[model samples]
Target: MVNFRKYISGITVLASGFFLAQSTVSTVLYTPAYENQKSTLNLPSPITSMVEKAILSPKELVDINVNTMMSDPVLKNATWGFVVYDPKTKKVISSYNENTPLVPASTTKLLTTETALSLLGENYRWMTQLEYSGSIDENGVLNGNLYIVGSGDPSLGTNKAGAWSYKEIVSDFVSGISREGIKKVNGDIIIQTALFKGNISRLPENVVWLENNNYYLPAGTTQEINPANEKLIVKKGNSFSAEKKYFYVSPYMNQMVYADKYDGDGILTTKLPDAPAYLANSFKTTLVKSGVSVTGKVTPRMTDGTPESRKMISAYKSPTLADIVYYTNQHSDNSLAEALLKTVGFQKLGDQTSESGRSVVTEHLKDISFDLNGLSYVDGSGLSRSNLVTPISQVKYLTSLMNEKYYKTYLTSLPIGGQSGTLKRMFLGTGNGQIFAKTGTLSRVKTLAGYMKTNSGKTLVFSLLVNNYSGSVDMVKKRMEKILEPALDL
Candidate 1:
């Protein structure tokens, strides 16, 4: 419930941080010179008096706008949950069905990311190690299997911002091997993915899978496969040095895989059933091209324990958790969000399964005293329609973070209105630069939750969740914009 402030003469400043002017008419409509000109306009006295008598508080105006939108034909049957809260006064400014749980869409990333940052810290990094099981002889000829150990790093070999490209990663590994005086005879390239012990398929059941799109498969799934009808094609040219030879093959049974002629960056688009195996194959190819012979093929090994004799040769560290969180929130990256959720489970609960991650997030929320009534957290990314949260709960969770140590990191990671990420084209007029929030969208669902700076220089946290609307997504967005536009003056 809101505490309404009484209106006074001249100017009234409410404790709720809104300024009101007690005037016959709005300043925009009635200037000082309008007193003399009012008679010339020949307006009816009753109409002029009615215009002068109409004065509404900010809260009342927002309520009117929300009620009007709720009654609109397009949204007559929609379930809406909205809340605007002030941390300073510890008050709810405006709310509509705030306690009703609704599908949150991508806004679930907010929970996944915030939980990760709280548990993993800002500077935490994921490490992928290059190691060998056998020993190299004095002649640098005898060797054992080379192991590419993974710690469930999602950014490995990705083109994510601030992440190393696959080419660079391979080059570093090759250089490190060469520096160690290892010239030849690697038995095989083994990708070790035992860190996440069981069941690596992280996608929720409700997420839709598209054909010919890139997907992150289980840790040890095989990425490269040759179609029976397609033969490996090798073309020799004058520029092809002994150190570089191109082998083009159909990496996926459904799609062809080829290396960049100039850089050897294998451009892969199909779902990588086994990312580590693909990387291991890449390492084998590069090793052979660099004059190091591999006697065996690439393999993926999933064991609970690594041999004590294995020696680490090199390591690649991912960008810090902060960078990953920023990218996840700004872009609403589903894969990264899932990875972070699994990592949180692995780090805190010793299991990397989705259930474990969900439990971890639920426990974290409980620890923070957030109300769990009518809340259903199914997956890290809200791609699953099973995810549900009330608008009041979201606003409460957001308000609780104001005093946290990582609040700055969390706040800056959200998309800025009309400036960056998903919100770049939104809030282009008055809401521009005043909203720092996350946007969520799914079929018949749209959500927004974050902080807003009002025209009166007051900061407010808000959440607006809508479900089952009978209109285009763009139409819903326009209505949402209208509702938020009035809040800009609060």
Candidate 2:
């Protein structure tokens, strides 16, 4: 007696009603924002109403990307990004592609440094210890081999390595050995740098600033390699024809008396780094005109690290782990990042080997609990395309840094905008640097991630990452830098 057609119609209506009801469920449930107060925000219609009402009816935060704003070709084409967070309301304002994982380039360092700060601390410095297993006498003469141990010193045999000259490290080793009442070593000097345990790749192919052959950490191997000293290399480049040739000066203890003229052209690639490699290689170009070579000489090394380095006496005591982290964040040194990653692995896994170290770091990051899928990390130095990260996880890592005691120190440790470090002169005229955040870059990827206050004076964390795009990075950089300026007027 029942009508089958009627019953079917009834069920269909019910399903439709259910779906419509579900659609009606407010998005404000997830994101915190004042739909009305957010009227000023340039967003879609549905989200605008939702946000407007949420401000009137409730108070909280979340991100809702159930819209086409992000997928919109115009916006998406202009900036390959998704941002949802308000510094003013301390909540997620809007989002698109929020979950899509994108390569963050150097922005990944924010995560590495921030995670390191929370787990490692600000007062931490790398320790370069000196161990000797030989006999010394009152005559200041060593009768055995002097072992110099390295644990990934970012600033060894380079000025930033320790503010001391390679000569000083040598002198310190001699003085320390002398203090230990020893001179005239009768045994070989063995430099033991087995601290880091990983395969380090060699320097990049486009390297030009090897002002000194001291930028020794190539990519594929991982071990605590020590440069001879804390030397900031200086190279002067001359534009010979349309080509450039450079002469390098070592951070010798002796003052450089370059009182000569009659050079090639006026281009001094000075301030080249001595160690922690990449920075040193940053000073060059290829022989475009062909048949171009450099003819520069060291004032005269006390003696390079040839077979003779075996007899050099020295001590190896690194700074605290915290100091090491600060230096890494501030200077943005690549080799140093590799060393720290290994150290973290060694610290966490209890095995000072690269395999274990990589595992430890990976495991620790997983413990972070952010949903980062398809993100692979082989080394800490983002030098590897094998490394991957999502915007969400990196932000989570930064948020975790808040729990640290020296978090302020950690914050400052980041290169400031337009002031010092990597970011110096970048956003200097922005007036925004009176307060704001960080920047990171590498081949094909550009990212700006960090904290900044909104127009309401409430600080909000944001990250903008652009990857795999074929265009002018310089233009992209300009566009990215301009976005943060007047928007909040910060």
lDDT of each: 0.73, 0.47
Residues 128-216 of candidate 1 have per-residue lDDT tens digits of 88987777889787478787889998787776759887778889999988877888865877777865555444333234321112222
Name the regions of candidate 1 deviating beyond 4 angstroms: 1-54, 200-271, 304-306
How does candidate 2 fare on TM-score?
A: 0.60
Clashes of 1: 2
In model 1, what is the error at residue 72, expressed in angstroms?
1.1
- The C-alpha stretches of model 2 lying farther than 4 A from their native spots are 1-79, 84-90, 131-141, 161-163, 202-317, 350-355, 428-431, 485-490
Residue-by-residue lDDT tens digits, candidate 2, 349-393: 655554665676666667766455756666665545556666655
Measured over all alpha carbons after superposition, the RMSD of each candidate to the real structure, in angstroms, is 10.9, 14.4
User: Which candidate leads in TM-score?
Assistant: 1
The TM-score of predicted model 1 comes to 0.78
